[model samples]
Target: MAARLLIGVLAVSGLGLALSLVAGTVLLRDYLYGRVAEQVSGLSQAPDVRPGAIAPSRLCEVTDAPAVLPSDFRLTVIEADGSVRCRVPGDQTGPPVPSVDELRDWADDDAAAVVRDDSGSWATSVDAFDQPGRDGGKGYVMVAISLRNADLTVQRVAVGGAAIGVVVLAVLALAGRMVIRIGLRPLTDVREAAREIRHGDLSARVPPGKPGTEVADLSTALNSMLEEIQRGFEKRRESEQRIRQFATDASHELRTPLTSIKGYAQLYAQMAARNTGSDAGTSIAREARKDVEQRRAEVVSRIDSEADRMSGIVEDLLLLARLDQQPELVKERVDLVEIAHDVLTAARAGHPERRLDLKVEGPVEVEGDPGRLQQVVANLVTNAIVHTPSAIVVAAATTDGVAVLEVRDDGPGMPAEVQHRIFDRFYRADVGRSRRSGGSGLGLSIVRALVEAHGGSLECVSSVARGSTFTVTLPRAS
Candidate 1:
């Protein structure tokens, strides 16, 4: 690109120089000829010639003429009858002279003509040479000044001008190349940085040269993009680590239930074997069998409870996985107030010991999947009931084109540190309590995911000894 720029500049400069040279050369040639014509005309108008007896006029010799006339100027006298005469050394041929008709026209009209021939070029000036005190009676005097030297001068000037133009163009090309290289240095740096980045170096960046230029803007943008990419890569690695840990935790959790079931089954089998192999009296054997049957029933009940707990955890995990994939939801207008009321009624019925307060202004509808939306409300109410022993407040209202649902609890509030990760999957504020209470720790995470999938936002506000509040905001249907 730089080379192309230099070539373009040179081409334009060369064209302008060519035009200037031609105009200047023509002006110089015209001025030189004008000066020659003036001299020839002046010399011809002189009145110092004497006529001969036989010759019509015996013009003064060019060398013997007045000093005002140029030395190389050749003089010619033309009579009224179209005869030509000139005084010159017998050994040298005089230069080409103007024709008789040209001479007569000049003498009659007092005009001049520049004539050229093989011998050389001349500026011819003719004037009537009348005797003193006579009325236009004598012949005409014509003077020819050689233009060979003037032609040679013009040619030399043209050659010098062409050489100067060539030198100027060469200098311009060199200067242009240097300027272009300096101007485009930033681009070279950018290219090298880009190459490094392409090879997996996200930290590479172009150094911003001077500010307030295109290069500076590009550098800033590229650096910003690199920063974003690096952050995304770090986030992805963090997510992968979290997933691996989650898988391990899930396996450990599933194994606990399975292990309990297996232990109970083994105990039941051992008891049955003992009952079958009794070799005592009938009454003692019957009594031992009855005791063994009761113990076996308790073992089976424990196994059934563990299986239910495992099934709940598996179902919650599957729900979370499906939410992660962003499944399409039903797009229907649902009333948040109605959902909140229903959820509150269920929570109150299930946990009658806990006080549930529901405050709903009116119908606040939003476009969403009714089932998912109801699930969101249920999860929040359930999470509050399980975590806190205080009263649960469920509120729904419409404010500023948004449908707001909030579930607040005054139970043993969480710490500020725990509040940050409360919405993370499988994150439990009190792990031991959560496990004993059959809390899968995915309630808040699923609530947040469901809220967001409805084009809304969910946030948790909680502090130790202070009640926790979960607020969900969804855009109201237009």
Candidate 2:
């Protein structure tokens, strides 16, 4: 592209230079010819010299005869019969005089004509005069100047101008190429970045260009677009991973309950079959039947419990799906402090031995679905209670047009790595404990989703052995 542009620049410049040279040469040639013609015309008007004044057959040496005549001027006297009567500056010769027809043609128009011969080119003019002492006799005086110097001057100017134009064009081409390369450096960077991206380097970026230029703006815009694309790809990858994990977790969760239910059902069936074949009146058989009935009842209760647990997990999964799809909520102004008090009250009643405290700074009112908001608070409180066996504090306050709810516990805090995935669905800090305690690991995930759905944010700050604090911030009601 740069080469083509430079070529185009040179082409246009060369054309202009060529036209200028032609025009200048033509104008200079015309001016030079006009000066020569003026000199010839002036000389032709000089005083007429009679033929008797000069000796016949001897050149009339009029070198100093007239101050108006230049040294290179050639003067000639022509007779009516096309003969040279005299010559001026006698040593100047070989440019023979004009013929009678040419002299008559010049005499008729009172104009000058260019005459060329072996000596050189000349500007010649002629005028007719009446010859003294000759009846009905006419003669012509011809005046001329050489054009060698003028022609040489025009030639030198044309050649010099052409050479200068070529040098200037070459310089322009070199400079233009360098400038174009510098100007297009940003685009080269962008191309390299794109190549890297195509090779799977998502972090590549174009170098910035000169500020306020089109190239700079383009570079900035391209960098922004690349960033968005990279982010989109990363998000897609994370989502896929999460989806796979969710499926695996769901299958494992359902499998455990199903396995237990199936085992108990099979045991109950074996017990019933054995009891059906026994003697009803025998004491040993009656005792055996009574023990089997009790065992069967226990087995049936266990199966029902497992089924309920499985059903709860399924319900939680469906709720998450709905929330992920942006479920509609009944949003209204509600006091977060009131919600916090209720959640803490329930937590205290459930775990009466645990120390639970409620701190309300003000009536923290926010716009949100009351039921979902209550669930969000309950989940956070429950998560804290399950993980930490220390004093738990549930706080509510309002500041800066936002309502803040916090659940804090004085127990072993989570590590940074754990905190990062703490809110991921089915991610348990203690998997065995979580499962044994009937935790599906969806508490924090649901809490986060519910908070976000109400235009709120959830954040956790934790360090190993430093205790953890979960804070939820929602926009205050207007």
Candidate 3:
């Protein structure tokens, strides 16, 4: 993230710098060209050419061999005779023809200039001077200078700016790493603390020092997590204790029943082995049959009840395990209303007498795992069915960019205290009643986990004996 941040910042800066350099170069070119054009116009628009009639041979002495004389050009320059003075033919390198043409509209007596093409590339600036003749006649005088060398000045500025930008970027990157290293020092300490904690040092804590900005927030978050872990360990210990106690108590309870059943069975067997009267045999057989039947029924009931409880526990554990191991969901749009109706149809079977106030409304689609999300909805609806007293009203709709499916049951509303603990595993408001009613106590917990896995939120409102309402909100795909 840090490296990318730096690159993003530099990319923006580089672009701005490049654009500024380009604009500055263009402006400078215009300025330089304007200055040279003004000089040429000034000399050409004058009343007459003056003293110096520098020949190409002499001009080459002062200027480079690449220089051109100003009196020769393709364009017609109006001389003092009102006739066009086409290039009077000087074997000299000259200034830019474009610049000379721009200056051709000068006064009649002005030093009318022309462009000369001595070098293959004509690149220069020109100036003209008028020399007075013997009888007040006009003689044209022209001066030339090359532009190829002068324009190099503009390019240098652009190159210099680009070089400076590169230097600035290098300096920032070098200094930025040092700054980030210093900035993240506190995090390094926190990381080390976490590593040590992972290795069984539960008592380890980040030093309560003011490390720096947001270090406090990081510490607070980590501390909260550790505190939660500590509390979870305590809960597990308590749960294990309960399990052991239940195992011991259940074994003791089973032993008494087993002894009674075994004693009766043995007594019947002994009588059958000794007593040989036909009437006696029949009497013993009847008595033994009754005892065996009663014992068998009691054993079956115990096993069935306990097995149900154990199975529910296993299912809850499995659901939680799946939730923790969030697998990739096959995301696709599915109409949830159809699934809701199907679930409702199943739930109705459980409560035939109760007036099921169900409201199913939809056609709203969502991007989610269809099966898991359907399970979530089913659990929530079932929870309400078991808890609500009056009527179960389910409604599905698409609203406010979210596909909201709500199940409200007019049952006994749960108190705030019970509502707080309802989503916990093995938690039940009326434990005795819930168990008797075949409640596994994991329904709500499973519901919550499934909702979260879909990146959705589930909320419940309960009024004891009045009703409990559960609202599920999922993002709409269409």
**Residue-wise lDDT of candidate 3 within 346-428, one digit each (tens)?**
87897787665546554878898888878887887776666555667778899899988888876668799988877766566
Ranking by TM-score: 2, 1, 3
Model 1: colliding residue pairs: none
List the lowest-lDDT window of 10 residues for candidate 3. 57-66
Q: What lDDT does each candidate get?
A: 0.80, 0.84, 0.63
Worst 10 residues of 2 by lDDT: 50-59
**Candidate number with greatest TM-score:** 2
Which runs in model 1 stand beyond 4 Å of their true positions? 45-56, 60-68, 76-94, 97-121, 124-142, 152-156, 159-307, 317-374, 388-404, 410-421, 424-438, 449-457, 473-478
Task: Write down the TM-score of every candidate.
Answer: 0.64, 0.80, 0.42
Index of the highest-lDDT prediction? 2
lDDT of 2 at 378: 91
Which ranges in model 3 have alpha carbons more than 4 Å from their true place? 1-298, 301-305, 431-434, 463-466
Q: Mind giving the per-residue lDDT tens digits that candidate 1 earns over 1-478?
A: 8888899999999999999999999999999998988877766665443243222244433444434235686666665555655543223444454556765678776445688778778887777665444465566666777898999989999999999999999999999899998988888888898899889887888898689988899888988988898899889988998899677668777888899999999999999899889966788888888899999999999999999989988988898888889988889989988888888888888888989998988889999998899999999888887777789899999999898989998777878788878887777666663476647677788888888888899998887788889999999999
Per-residue error for 402 in candidate 2, Å, reads 4.9
